[model samples]
Target: MSTSWRDRFEKNFISPEKKLGLDEILEEAHDAYLGWLAASLTAFHSDFNEDQVDQLDRIFQGESRIRSIANDCYNYAINGRFRLAKDAQEQEQMNDDWVCLAILVQSARPGIEEFSLTVRGRPIGVPAKLEQLLFHAQIRALLDFSTVDGFDEESVSVPQFFSQPVPGYLTLKEIALLGQMSERAVRNAAQPAAADRLQTRKEQTQTVVDATEALRWLKGRRGFIATRAD
Candidate 1:
């Protein structure tokens, strides 16, 4: 029996190659990551209805597989490898990271976390904690978004929806859209400039909290003492 085109592709392109040395492994991982990112973004776009795709295409300036690859690359580089953990404990930790990222993304908008969590099958409990962790990931995502100088502004800010700290799960875009008069209005008003403002507000809030915590920790140090009232 002969192999079909699909079977040939499965055997050649989809199957994991033999493990290599550390450098080679990283190179291979990077290549694989790029391929996976492209596929995933294509899948995401394909999942949208024609109207939705048309709206996004206008806002984003066109279909952008490169932007998708860049996003995935940034994620992999900052978060390290995406390999499943070796044991149940490690797997749980991985799950925790995913949940946290989902929460952060959801918080920025609203529906994003739920959408990502539902799609990813993350648990509902301890969502707040997960969002905190995702805040860190969102920071990394932000930095990466900033690095791609030529990417469309609207596309760049779209990821900010994942950087917020909101209650429960929601996808980034969904949360952002909830504030609009209606879903159609949101789609019509989609602009990178607006998204940037929302992201800036969230980051500023996080900075204040971090500074406050630092001050509190300094006050609690062994040698620190509060000034007495005159």
Candidate 2:
């Protein structure tokens, strides 16, 4: 009878004496978790928009609450604290949780759209694709924030262009190019009339100096010094 029981046990379980080491199990889990994270982030990135990306960048720049929520979800997924194993359901839940947290973090911003919008400016509600894109953008932003050194914590001020009531907007490519230009050169390139208008507006209204203005101001000062008599 004992021999028969032994045989049955061996048949039912291939490894009666051998067991998976904790480190080995954890390593496997880590690899799987990382894989899932990468795939999900990739899917999200494929459809992200500029606005959503900006929001995520802010969150990554050390928003304490956002960090906490994301860390909680990550810990739960990696440690298998909320599930028996990292299966499909677990992976989906982790992804969903991350998206939810990102939304919450972004919603905290002032003047943020209510995760809902229509192409025609009507209230059609937020689509799943948009939501996913926003979520992914936030992730990217956070990652960028983490890698960036010496980011300013204070809110940035913007300037109006062309004497218009509305603020000016620039394309990403334009902005990148502008960043490479010397401050003096940028200001020097601005039309004298436009520069005068900008100065007048600056004196009249309380506006935060933007990157462009900073560069222009620096250039102006340098030119003034160079032309001055010794």
Candidate 3:
């Protein structure tokens, strides 16, 4: 087996044709990480209602840890940190790097270290519910989210669309982020001067769009997936 993290990751995690420049790769990785988190919630909390899962999904976006992890892991592999795994221990360490990234990204809170199954650096008799949830979710994320053979049925796949709940009203920034477009683009589209302009209303100093109008405008655009609230 190849010991190099970069080589192993390239061979296992992504399809050859899907590889791109660093920036593009990182962008896709970030999107994929968030998508996975959102999609995986149901598996982690099967008994939880849709509202519960939606609430948890919102919590996942509270911190940008997943984006940070994607960048850090990409940089680690690209910056010559990946070494040839010559022995069992070395190979395990290489695997841990990926696992660590998965674990950290699963944190709903700002500081992942706070989720450590410990207090003041000391182990506890029983881990807290949140701690256990994050721990197991990370393991499942690595195993199921990866393109590795045996672990996943699909050898190659694209990031699937994950729906986020939309509020009755959204700021231009929120619309841009939710729609996977730029704020500039959203602003331009919302401008009165634009043809087929998106309808908007002002809230204090900020401009906001009605969710129904936003979706109507967005639905006509290429690659725009509709989001709903229950």
Candidate 4:
């Protein structure tokens, strides 16, 4: 049997007499996607406890809604309804949402990376635990960077969201290179933001940037990101 949203999508293509605009078509497709997602989660719920099932439902549903909204943003970007900066902002938001979706789904996925065994049936090892923590931190970092919500799923050019680098640890030399400054200048800039985030070793004598902490700093202090000429 065809679903309500599925019927709508099918109608959009099959009902030649009916005329719907691009925006309407996008909404119909997005709603169908949500319906598919809800059905998938309902199936997955049988394997999880109440708490985990709730969380899984929330994570999937959350992105499903965001995808609908961001699809509009994507349309605006392509249609030139807004400025270049607006396009960039939409691109960045899409990127953020994509990252969040990956982290959330993988963190909740049943199987370990190395094997097909579900977390429900087996004890999570050190690697799995670390992966979960890293996902949480990435989510927090995304929140710290943008007050606006994030989104993704549709394919597009320009921003290349999937290809963008996930923020990673920055060595002193790397930070300096990214900032287009001397190593001394990088150290000076780090000093102010280094209060609680300083990750150092007595043996190494060099502070390292954990990926999440590094993202927070890079997002705000994007001195190295050269802007296109207006």
* Top model number, lDDT: 3
Residue range 1-230, candidate 4, lDDT tens digits: 11342243333322211222345434433333333333344465533443553465576666355455434333332221211223666768655654553433333333332222333233432222222222222333222222212322232322343332333354554444333345565566566576534342222575766544544554455343322211
TM-score: which candidate is best? Answer: 3
lDDT of 2: 0.31
**Candidate 2 lDDT, 136-211, residue by residue in tens:** 2222222222222321112121000001111322222122222333334434444465543222124234332333
- What TM-score does model 2 achieve against the real structure? 0.18
> Which lDDT tens digits does candidate 3 get at residues 2-111?
13522433333322112223465444444444334434543455333446534665776522554454454443222212123444565455455445454433332222
Q: Which ranges of candidate 1 are over 4 A from the true structure? A: 1-125, 149-152, 156-230
TM-score of each: 0.20, 0.18, 0.32, 0.25
Worst 10 residues of 2 by lDDT: 155-164
lDDT (tens digit, per residue) of candidate 1 on 155-205:
321322333332222222222211212323333333356432222113433
Error of 4 at 200 (Å): 61
Q: Is candidate 2 or candidate 3 better by TM-score?
A: 3
Candidate 2's error at 68, in angstroms? 3.4
> What local lDDT score does residue 211 receive in model 2, on the 0 to 100 scale?
35
Per-model root-mean-square deviation over C-alphas: 21.9, 26.7, 18.8, 18.4
